[model samples]
Target: MGNYQSGDNTIQGERLSRREAVFDKMDDDSFALFYAGRRKYSSGESLFPFAVNKDFYYLTGIEQEGSSLLLSKRGGECREFLFIDPYEESKRRFYGKKLSIDEAKRLTGIPNVLLSTYLTSRLDRLLRQGLDGEEPVKKGYFDYSPELKIGPELDVKTFVNSLKVVYPDLHDLDARPLVMPLRKCKSDSEVEEIKKAAGYAKEGLLSAYSVLRPGAYLYDLGLFYEHAANSASSCSGLCHLTHIASGEEACYRDPFPGQKQAKEGEIVLLDVGAKSGQYGASICRSVPVSGRYTPHQALIYKIVLNCLRAMENLARPLISLKRINEFALDYLACECLREGLLPSKEAIYSIAYPNMVCELGLDCPEDYGELTLEEGDVIALYPGLYLSGEATAIKLKDVYLVTERGCRRLSDADIEIEDIERRFALQSK
Candidate 1:
């Protein structure tokens, strides 16, 4: 069901199976629509490079503009259709030729491949009248979010409204509910893609670390990290901006690196995110600029590091993300109290002492914290500390694969204090 091809005309493998699984959850008269999105224009025909919609990519494995995937289950029969932009001589000369119908079929395993021109009419026809002996689609799911407020060519809100005005009985629903569950657990191929990104990320981390000197600036490290990451990636220009923060900004995750010079006693951050096959690996490291951490710096670093380790141990299946976050915060508070940094453990949660423990900025604090960890679930963990009085912060982040026993940290970077010091020492020589 996962990795098998059917006939000579179709390659019914990974993406096909993913679509089939989603179809199983859907009602018999429902259709799911996913847009690959278009190459956005910034100013005066200056187009932004296309990034395929994650859900659309997940289902079709096709990355292109003016493309969409439509999956419908009706009358006990599942149908899949892929729409791609038609080839044009001008487009071919400027950018590249669009995906051929045969190529689209081979890549997505969707036997019915159509051009973008036919998409609207095809959808209208399907939603209006019964087709191929199946009842008309009564309900529809879209990769849509009102909060996003984005206007792709097929804007879900606008399209839903227009279609509803014509067919008032058509029911519109969010595709995330049907599709997100399938994406929560990383498939083997997806895991491999993330691991590949992690490999690039580790190299980027070390590359940036190798150049860390007292005179170095955050901008310098960020440039080196981006260079190393993109060089290590399978695709060109795959690595985006490397987020590097210093002092209190470490907890804030500043993406724009500036000429903030390193100080002898200050710590600098190298928050690197690299990608492979659209899967990203996020790794954050805050290190001492002087090679060895100061006594007070090491103290805070140790607290945050210990909290991260404890969180890793607490990442077994069936545990809630919020519970894991709470455990880490509680552990940090206890350690802070032990160090006399906090007057009491309760101070950690005090509104006045908001910076006592750093906020989970990278972790998207409120996003999936309510969900319980499950085997094969891939989640990000950011354990951090912010000592407002000390005017410094420390945070550690890594992606984890939740397993039956415990979680496994995805990045293979050497991030321990001793390792950081040793690498800086060797690089200095």
Candidate 2:
């Protein structure tokens, strides 16, 4: 089947044929881990239900919590194994229905299935037997451990440590980088999924643009965005937070996840994404709160837009990600100085260090020099300029992608300041 589609639609079943084939081709003794847990939202339960880890779902297609996967490939023979929680009366009453053992086996195409509770015991026996070269199980790799939490928010290092106990004699592999390297380059189908996400994101922007005004609060904008994403498709905003920031707060990067009201003569920034068919897009756009661009805002917007445009022109196969950022950063420095946003080299240097260039996930390489951009590389380029004034301020951001030739702007919306102001005139007045 074709890897990508021109229209916005979910890719399920046979549509994911190629990805399934590739996952099955992974080396034996190797596995990937994914954990979906409840998130605490102040208003109520999170809008999105528990999210399945993208990589884990990519391989086994098992969407459930407390589940693990093992993929074995030896002598050209492939076997997919799934470990999941067995049926429990309390669990059924609490979290709704779970996949029965037989159903999971059929759905995952895995002839072998085991209850999650028996994983440690069964895996231990299997490892010993395989280590002895008796039961056709030889040196295996445990892709994850259920211990030692690390990094931001939901760390799962402990789960990784648990792997050591399960396959004591098997070789340990760094599955994170390995899996990330494979995921770095998007296939045609993956790109199409991202495009579908972008479509819903655009719809969210349209909804926000239609009602946004100077007096609108950031939290209000968030509601508008989520509503549009939800209305577009039942599953459009499956995973991810819809971020809406205004004026100086928009320039502050994370923005502390609070409410910021829109004001005239300020920039309203929306750095948001939507998920369709489990694939996602990271798109951002900025408009003037007053709906019309001010001379000062327009000047800075042009420079930031130019930086993003430059990235689009330079992104291609075989180029390093670090090198790409360097080029973009250098252009930004020059533009910022030329526009008088940053007074000197020192000022420009400080802002670009960790704030300007952000790597979205762990998949990106730490060193830009070692990372090369491949064809069909879906890169998110955020070019922003924040000018914080004592009373009135503005910040503008725009995200784009790199195609075979130049790049495409996924966040399609008008950038004029007045359009934003007038669109919300009824609410503001």
Candidate 3:
């Protein structure tokens, strides 16, 4: 299977292969249904920019709202169907023409294309036929996640409930278990997209470094980082929130940019990301506003860096996240004891202490809840520190691709303490 390419927009061939793989995994008499997400209202008269459902985009490569995909495996034969919003004059006038049926077919490589308005009738007919046929559909697979709240109009829960009322014998299956594994392991093309995003993130960090001086406001620094990423060719002018913090603010679990001004002899922390081809790269760095780190600050910075390196070394495929966390906790404890920061190993787990390591990902929320340790899953680490009873907080984040052999760092920005000091000194001169 080949990819669909048109101007700046193209879907990789691997996505098509992924869909095929899903089909091959499904039972012979089952069907899967996926929906493109609906646009949400930002305010009274404005709507947030439409973001396609990650799963739907993964399978169909169609990013438009009001779109759906149906894949059926019956009698040892598999077929694909695509449903999309039809051409409407008023909508076209307001938002330009949506993707045409012909273009959708070309983009998605689905042979059957129909207006989304026909979806209800089509599904009803198919389910009825299956009920009357010899090899009826044994299960209906739907994309459902309890964590995500869908609006009334686009609620899959209601649809599934109605389907049960009409066809009580049909079994419903959650598609997440089958699809999440495909998403976790990045393909070559997906890795390239992530690298592009990383490049943009590097540019943003460099831009921030240039203007990182005393009296600089955190908000302006965040804007500078965002502007650099948004201006990059690979970027689609969209990204996650940029976090910029100084001193005590940097030590917080999740810090947001504000009007706080940096002062002399203080370190500034930044956590930013750029999105390209719908993939994102997360990067974090810490810089000294005064162009030099205090001896104490430098020591703490090196500790966090060491922890990051240790985490990188442990990030191999089939390694459990729990193991990684245990390693980090033990490593941090040892370093703390050596540095005289901790009295004993028992104090390592104390929340009041410094040298904490947290997990970071593309979809990780800013206000992440308690970390759960899963034995069968891999982990990503972002290093940061908070010096107890002091006004110092430093954070550094980078994206890593967990490979079969080892982990590969995607965001390879210059984060060395000596390198940062050298750059600042050169700029000062």
Candidate 4:
């Protein structure tokens, strides 16, 4: 969500931010970046209690800006030091409500608290003492995503370099690799939250379908989807922009498009998802605004549906995601030729191969990985069908999980094209 806050906006009582939730679980000696800055609110400027990075929150469950977590196993004592903004009304007026140093410590359940103002001084002392005029320490860690992006604009690189000047023993450790290895797997709670989002996505899809008509604009449909997500909680809108493509624009890869209105009998593909408490689920369903798919539309729809079913049937615990993706491409390719949409199987496979530029605008091998669908795994499968230059297209997307006996669709939406037609016909009547 943009850092904007409006009158209608409410904090919803600070639940543990995802970063904090993650952080509270990390091993001692693991450190993470915490956000410390003013942010734009719809009403005006405000300070985030702190939006800790997801990985960090996954371990700590501490959320407050101007806070740094130093975890160490020294002297037989596990240290959880939290540095926070000192309580000041002037600061509050400028940045909004902030957890005072003590409040920050209490909220985090971490005992030791230090005034944020002393970070530079404390770091200086550590550097001087550790260096002792000997060979410099070689390794240190920090999140560099924001730094890299903002470096040119804010001389962030220079600031980092200056830190090295203070402590010549500096080694940069990238956090992405370390954290991604774990974040890829969801904890029980995390998985449940995702499923909740998936359920909401399905409900939202149905909500959109009911509103489908011949002349509605794409963004209007986007509103219906967002409304469904917000109905759950103060979700962070969407992790990405909504895509609602119609008519000629349906051939475009992603559903995001210019403000085109749906026309008579045009199939509209709505690709949307919601982020509930930061976890996200994406689901897409294509429908005929006129309440019935033409034969061509049905052909495309069935192709995508069969491919999706193939992926679902094969998904199992410990299957490589890369392999599954390959399987999806092969299934789509064979179906394309079998349906007489493409002339030959060899032609379909040739164009579908990696490194081969699909002459027909078909980019096969949609995504990578052979991630075996383990129990509790959540995966998004998007099977799309489009004739290179044709305006007609159909794509179905859903999040599924592999179970012990079979797979279950987490995105509980009405997926059948026939069902959609029936429902739309009833609604129109």
Candidate 5:
């Protein structure tokens, strides 16, 4: 995440440029709808906080819930409209102030701002009768996730996705193609924001050392990291969950790190991130609970650290993450073989499925092998080594920027053996 696209007056211009770029790609008689999704509830009376759609926020720079953006190149006219939840005095007093129409206009530079209630009717009207004596919209674009199951309710679908039911003849298109290229290659500002996020996340991880002694609960460590992350992020909180695991849990994937007690010998693995504006960074660190790595742990750590270094040394602009993956796998395999962990380089693939560095999984489409990365593309390098024989897992996560020179590290969260030993050495004295 480069500097967050906020506060600066120029950000509105950037949002406008993004919307214009989308429009430039669309055919005439085409329209696009981007939604700011509604929040979901976990249980009775409690609900998850609303997060704006990345595509929507990219174009509008608005984070309010239930907001929508409509762009059209219909007939002979090009139009842009922003729809927002109507201002209610009671809701404002209760839940605090949400975005008003004027504020949205000012923020997004979209002149045609309307209430959310008008969206359905307005779109229907546009499709039924052409405005300015022109043809109706024949094609529409929507950001539909591949994970969305084809179900009966169609209840939670975005407003544009529901258009299929109403007008089966409309040519619906995936919005990702038009937006992802722009997103995958971040702007200078976005790079700054991500750098800030990585620094903040590192701060959170370092702060956890305050409570990082033997016998501390993995759950409590997670809590400490979250609190520190939020504080470091200036109260915006986590962009995604923190992964804190120790001992057996560290040896495998456990989505939730629970009450596993730290021992003097085990390693604690933390995959932590924190937000700076809409950007966040992922960084992993594995450290010994005793504050000094044993010979075995150090061996594993160095192996994983070298795997990450491969990415930093090999990644460059115009190369795909797929290519980098191959280089890193080779490095990992050769290292394992040299250490007698494996017999041959080819044998590494057998275990590579669960223990590989795939940064595309974090930000880009699944089929990112062919997509050429440009300068400023940020990616995470998280290499995990699970040694069931030793009952331990070694991992290191870092975020890097693809540059002409190589992959420039945005987050290098080091868990050096010397640093750990020195910290505890002072305590022992």
Candidate 6:
């Protein structure tokens, strides 16, 4: 979106500070290695768009592939080195210009920049050199996750494994535990990017709402949102598949936008968003297929909307996701009971609706454990209601920023019944 500047000095300074923090946690004579993921193969001769590793991108803003960051602490001094793909005329002709060492230094604030080919040599030298007659490097930290097993070629696992073979005495550590806590809170710049993404998402949803009507295919409604987002100067496109379901299809768990056609008096459920600067926004809304909601549809929509509102009001610094989830169930239970959707509090879990509030940031629907809210945490509250006997399902999803004074909504679209009816009526006229 717009002219993408790699990052500014302030951003670079922040990244450097983050690296320093990681080094501070390391024991003496310890080091850590992180890598920018490799390009993935989609099919013969074609490749998937390069997605940078979140942990690597968090410490260094460089997004290019085959790059590596090495952070080492010795005695009282910490050293940082960044190794990236070296400039090659052939690559420049085929893939455009690769990032130069000077540019990488400017972007990441790491002065020690070298070619990727030299990474092993550098590590070998470090391992061989010992100060005060002790091992030069005692512990090595890396980001390890089960997902890494799926794509060994794109991760640092192979490289670390090879190191273990040569230096059997070296201790290996998982850096995810060290970096995950740092990632939980968002910086001001990161929050701004997320907010921009949310704003673009709101525009996309509004466009989808205006054109939704009886007989429109669910896929077409999804395209309306994608088109609106793709045309924006700030939006890259829909971050994930737009979820659009109508009638009985709405009750389908994890529905994807399909060819199902809308009908009069049917409720359509949608979950969609756009990406801004690699950050994603998640927003979901429900509306009647016709210009106006039926009485029953309106009742379910209002209940879920109220649940979302209550949860948003309660979000703030120090509020754990466990607390938010408990509040949502309690509020939903009371409302469902009042509406006769549930027979009693004991039957709360029997309702077949998705009622989870998760953190949304660099990744959409991040791991639930990572969604716990603290000051500076950005989260999504998505609550749904499904009446299996009636074959009806409705949901509302929104993102919020946990601030000192509570929380502020990042994804805001008018889901109020009056607003939807008025907008749809205008479109019909």
- Highest lDDT, which number? 6
Question: Lowest summed lDDT over 10 consecutive residues: which window, candidate 6?
Answer: 1-10
Query: Which segments of candidate 2 are over 4 A away from where they belong?
Result: 1-49, 73-76, 87-93, 101-106, 131-140, 144-170, 235-239, 256-259, 350-369, 390-406, 409-411, 415-429
In terms of lDDT, which candidate is stronger, 4 or 5?
Answer: 5
**lDDT (Cα atoms) of all candidates against the true structure:** 0.73, 0.58, 0.73, 0.59, 0.73, 0.78
Cα lDDT of model 1 by residue, 206-288, tens digit: 88887777777788888888888888995534434667867656545454677777777878777677888777777778888
Least well predicted 10-residue stretch by lDDT in candidate 3: 359-368
lDDT string, candidate 3, 128-232, tens digits: 775235445658888885432245254787778878998887789987655665665566666677778878988888888888899988888888888898888
lDDT of 2 by residue, 1-107 (tens): 12223223333443244234545545654433333333333355443345555456665566676677655444555444567878877888777788898887656
User: On residues 27-51, what C-alpha lDDT tens digit does candidate 6 reach at each position?
Assistant: 7788888877777777787877777
Give per-residue CA lDDT, model 4, range 1-429, as digits (tens).
112222322222122233333344443333333333222233444422333345445444444444565443222233445667677788777667867765664455556677877766645544454213432334444555452221113433455578788667665555445445445544556666667777777667777776778778777787787787667546545544678888767766565745778888888888777766566777778888888888987887888888788878877777766666677777777888777777776565433332211000000111223345456556677767655456766778877655776567766677898788888888888
Q: What TM-score does prediction 2 earn? A: 0.77
Comparing 2 and 4 by lDDT, which wins? 4
Cα displacement (Å) at residue 176, model 2? 2.2
lDDT of 3 at 193: 73
Q: What CA RMSD would you report for each candidate?
A: 3.8, 5.7, 4.3, 7.9, 4.0, 3.9
Q: State the displacement of the C-alpha of residue 165, model 2, in Å, after optimal TM-score superposition.
A: 6.5
Candidate 4, residue 147: Cα displacement in angstroms equals: 7.2
Local accuracy of candidate 5 as per-residue lDDT tens digits, 1-429: 112244434777677778778888888888887777766666886866776677788888888877888888864357888889888888887877988787877787788899998988778866766545455677888778633222222323444546767776678888778876667767777778788888888888877766778888878888878887888888766666788887766666644668777888888888777777787777778877887888988997888877777677777777766777777778878888989888898887554544344442123222333676677678877776776667677778787778877778876555566776786676556
**Model 5 regions more than 4 Å off:** 1-9, 146-168, 349-355, 358-369, 424-429
TM for every model, in the order presented, reads 0.90, 0.77, 0.88, 0.77, 0.90, 0.91
Please report, as a residue range, the 10-residue window in candidate 5 with the lowest summed lDDT.
Answer: 147-156
> Pairing residues by index, what is the TM-score of model 4?
0.77
